[model samples]
Target: MANEYYEFFCPVKMVAGFKALEHIPFELSSHDASRPLIITDRGVRGVGLVDIVTKALEAADMQAIDIFDDVPPDSSMITVATIAALYREKECDSILAIGGGSVIDTAKGVNILVSEGGDDLRAYSGTGVVKSPLNPFFVIPTTAGTGSETTNVSVIKDDKTGAKVPFVSPFLLPDAAILDPRMTLSLPPKITAATGMDALTHAVESFTGLAKNPISDAYATAAMKKIVTHLPEVLKNPSDAAGRLQLAEASTMAGIAFSNSMVGMVHSLGHSVGAKCHVPHGLCMSILMPHVLEFNLSVSSENIGELLLHVAGSDVYASTPVAERPAKAIATIIALKEEMYALCELPRKLSETGSVKETDLEDIARMALDDGSMLLNPIDATFEQALSVLKKAF
Candidate 1:
């Protein structure tokens, strides 16, 4: 992370703390965007999150342009188009995404179409493709994971092409990201455990990945320390508003880190495992994080060792031999997973996921070699090595 040439950028305004949702109306007014469409999914609306946001807006005497709450888990280009059409019909001037990854991504896709006047996302499906800025967009993530609120990437499944299309552009960044404890207080124990682990993985991968720089490392390490300290506290008492806020901050910090430094083999293998096995993405990261880190230890040992100071306390890091800190960090991750498994039944093995079978290992490894995230890994993984890692994880 020292003396390296790298790029980092995160322009989205962050509004976090108690009653952060109350600032949404002011943020909208700052962007001169009053008629904003609320994009969400059934899970968020069902949990009364949308109602909470809506009430906040109404308290400010602001009415939303519309509320689209049918966003599917695998949001498609067609969904983006429908939202764009509704945005036009309702004369929406902005977008407020209020859910997890899929909803935020759908909102980004809709902003692309409505702001740029296009029905097909294929026209802007690659890196740096969007030339113009999007509409006044904002996000309020219901879960403290994924960090889609801070990233400049959106993946919309193109049902026409049968591919999960990646729309990468700085223009995809939102005007603001609102974090309030109220948004995540409803998360179940298992979900909290999984998403917390996911954020921790993002920080670890960013700090240890090939593109790490001083700026990203700062965000990544801070994120790791916060997640390590606060995740269990939140799991023990879900009503802990302060802990919920800390977890949210960690997720956003990790998001900022990876958005600049990117991820590595863990995400590569995790993505493949998720695609092939239908395992939840966070659980895939949780199960595979330590294994992938151990594999990368051959080349990333020093950086991995430094992570011990964040994963465990500085006192533990100081007590451990420097030569053994990386191993200690890896052991700390395993212990965290064990605690989560006991607290919330978060699976510690691929087989325990109930979705992945032994036969799926080879296919998962093969798919992982093609994953873009693998390119950033310090180790240039091959099919056999990826398979070896998957088999070990299984």
Candidate 2:
């Protein structure tokens, strides 16, 4: 194992199943949260799940002091400040984030200000900057991707700079996470595919990146196997409770893996594209994953080959020389992405998305170079390399 050193740091008490939302009140009680601010987006509120959650809290004798449902897809610092003001006004002692990454990141951002009384969120930009723990925060992810519920990082955009800043702090990790399959039942098929692919991206990147460790590799391998087996089934039948549960578990495991070890070029490029071009985060991830894997194969082939064997139960490594493993792994990932796209009827290329342009390649490459996630890449990427990867996607 080459003296493998691993650090596992998921602090969230994850409760996942069919009726997971019904148990949140008890989880809140364990954290001594009497008054919680439920943070979600307007879309969630429109779906009426917010009312169901409110009733559950009421049943558990926990007061829902405020419900902030103003979060947008790519949440901004202004939105975080607005939610923080509301949190203070309501005198809420805890946060219940109940939606996708945007809602969870918004809750994490609001927690920073509500706990520390800061007007500017950019003050705590770097890792481990928060000295004190935030309020009792519980993350209930509505989607089966992003793993924001179990991560120590929260991504929020700064409107002034148009830069996506990640707030990395142990304090930002949710104290509890509820992963009910029912919460994901209402997700559209496109969302299911995108988020599932996002989870797959996390596992693949974590396993193949420079920071791979035995523990994270174990989690990533398990997540990859489960996702590869179950994602197609879940897409075929979204209401299949068993399939949904497996997908949710896979997403959680992938989140834990990537949060500790971090993701690579796919995320770097995805984050840049999402920030600049206004593409959905998961969609960008899905579009760029195959190309990024191909680009990373030269340096990351051995790790990727092992992961491929784990996911597909095929020892392409043993059949081929070590020199050929990377190319084989890259080809495997490309094939898997094509299969997923066919199964889910999703777009396979950046050109299929109709949002990106051949002209945007330079800007995307520059932004990706500046992305924090790029540091974890197995190989140092040149602007030309990034441009080539983007071109392949396009």
Model 1 whole-model lDDT (C-alpha atoms): 0.93
**What lDDT tens digits, residue by residue, belong to model 2 across residues 1-394?**
5865768787778888867888887887777778898899999889887887888777777768988888998879999999888888878889999898889888899899899887899998988889898889988888888888888888899999997888888889888888877778788888888898899899989988878887888889999888888878887887888888888889999999998889999999998887668788888888898788777777766676676575565655467666766666667666766776777767788788788888888999999998878998987899999999998898
Worst 10 residues of 1 by lDDT: 1-10
Flag regions of model 1 displaced more than 4 Å. 1-3
Q: Candidate 2: TM-score? A: 0.92
Reference-based lDDT, each prediction: 0.93, 0.84
User: Which runs in model 2 stand beyond 4 Å of their true positions?
Assistant: 1-6, 314-328
Report the lDDT tens digits of candidate 1 across residue range 1-394: 6666899999989999999999999999999989989999988999899999989999999988799999999989999999999999999999999999999999999999998887887898899989988889999999998999999999989997789999999999999999999999999989998999999999999999989999999999999999989999999999999999999999999999999999999999999999988899999999999999999999999999999999998899999999999999999999999999988889999999999999999999999999999999999998999999998998
- Candidate 1 matches the true fold with a TM-score of 0.98
**RMSD score of candidate 1 (Å):** 1.2
Q: TM-scores across all candidates?
A: 0.98, 0.92
